[model samples]
Target: MRWIEAWTKIQTLFIPGVAGLREVVQGTRTTHPSDQLQCPQDFPLLLPSLILHSVSYDRTLEEIKWKLHEGQAHNALNELCQVLQSRAYMLKFKDSFL
Candidate 1:
């Protein structure tokens, strides 16, 4: 259930950027404006690909390629979400100094 909450939070984090999101939900374009957005330098590249793979294993390679093209946007948000979920699982000690 915590994971569901975490995922919900992740979704909310992205709620404000529906301009690019609208294009996706409406299936009007294969490409998105957020595709041009930049991934944070501190974020690892492999993480997003892994998240994308896990969440959408059935997706075609072309679709994955489109989703991860510029290493930004929803891909990054999804990656960060998986990371957050993992950390939340360790909530008992997430802030412990020991």
Candidate 2:
């Protein structure tokens, strides 16, 4: 359920048009009339910002997993705490925007 909610929010942010978020992220333009969704030009940083955030989260999780696999439970726990703190800060920041 949480995964579904997260994915839905991602889809909402990068609402796909005929051109798709991938094309916009790559700085490509499509000539199709239906290619315009949320006016990517108006929010040029949105897709890349989301992509970067997602990548950072994934990398952090992978590092934590690797640490655990190596029996470095203490380091993994510390990293997890830091990630939670970062997430809390982000949530507060997002709420400020709202």
Candidate 3:
């Protein structure tokens, strides 16, 4: 499915750096000398970008929390399953090339 493909791409391209950033921000991880050479510590623009991303992540999480509170989690999951099944059916139909 397209959504799954997109999620996989994000996991491959974006997740590792974010995880590293999180560790750096939390003071739990340090970059090796060679790693610093690749993404120098003195990069002036990095802080603002990291802050923006952190805020965006926080806002998204808050929205999901409220949405879950408004709807029963089980109902939300059932709706998701229905959507995925419908999309799968459409994909299969298209693949049939009729």
Candidate 4:
């Protein structure tokens, strides 16, 4: 199997409820070993929503590729620098429009 495919099969343990866990295909399911996952710092937020959010089969691999190559969240934080700066200015000046 390919490296990515092999990596994909392994699930992570997430204690959902009292003694009731599920083996979900994605988004942090219960795994026998912890080493199976190599998650980033934002893993806590990403894991819960990986499967909950949808990407077409054709695009899933592409999205994964971008995730691996890009810094984080499709580089959303970087992309929104202007917006963040504007918000920061407004908040500093107590602008009501903000």
Candidate 5:
């Protein structure tokens, strides 16, 4: 199968408490206004909800593409690498002062 479809299937597997999550081939389920899902504060639920949320489907791939375009345009990958590199230093500084 195509990579995007494979990726989507893989992502569905990581969603917690969801059984048999499949791509909507026909249409979406109708939901009442008051029956909508509320975002939970717990990390386990929150992370999956954030990852699987409909808004992410539009922007995540674009964001990844932008981050991967290192030298062609803005070096977001370099900026991310710098942030990652500084993480340990920041933690050490915090531990020393706080």
Candidate 6:
């Protein structure tokens, strides 16, 4: 499926810097770092939350609170993921049953 492939590509894009990603996030604004992902199926804000959830250390909770206050992406992203999955499943059943 195209969506799976796309998600795979997105996962690959993230695979490179896991070791140094925290430093990169903390060190400098050389790049958004998160921009390298291809996440059409993902909530735009979900991407950052996903990253935060993944590599966040003890301070990540505080950081997440900050991001939540500053950005509306977290809630929006969760909703978007549910919507996309529901729609995708609907399409699948529609194609298969009808």
RMSD of each: 18.7, 17.5, 13.4, 14.3, 14.2, 15.6
Better of 1 and 4 by lDDT: 1
Cα error, residue 51 of model 2, in Å, equals 48
lDDT of 5 by residue, 8-69 (tens): 55655544223233323211331466533343321122234444553234445556656766
Q: Which residue runs does candidate 4 get wrong by more than 4 Å?
A: 1-74, 95-98
Misplaced by over 4 Å in model 5 are 1-74
lDDT of 3 by residue, 1-98 (tens): 45544554563353344445544553433345443423334332223234555533435545665787778877888999999999999999999976
The candidate scoring highest on lDDT is 6
**Residue 25 CA displacement from its true place in model 4, Å:** 18
lDDT score for residue 82 of model 6: 97
lDDT of 6 by residue, 3-87 (tens): 6557546644554333365345434533577754455443232244566556534555567678877677777888899999999
lDDT of 4 by residue, 15-97 (tens): 12211222233335434566454654322232323544432223454577667778776578777997899888889888665
Off-target runs (Cα >4 Å) in candidate 3 are 1-71
lDDT of each: 0.50, 0.55, 0.54, 0.46, 0.48, 0.58
What is the descending lDDT order?
Answer: 6, 2, 3, 1, 5, 4
Model 1 stretches with alpha carbons more than 4 Å out: 1-71, 92-98
Candidate 1 lDDT, tens digit per residue, 4-95? 44654564453334233434543543257755424444222222344453333334645666767766787788999999988887885766
Model 2, which residues run further than 4 Å from truth? 1-71
Which is the winner by TM-score between candidate 4 and candidate 6?
6
Clashing pairs in 2: none
What are the models' TM-scores?
0.23, 0.27, 0.28, 0.22, 0.24, 0.30
- Candidates sorted by TM-score, descending order? 6, 3, 2, 5, 1, 4
Error of 6 at 43 (Å): 36
User: How well does candidate 1 match the true structure in TM-score terms?
Assistant: 0.23
Residue 8's C-alpha lDDT in candidate 5?
50
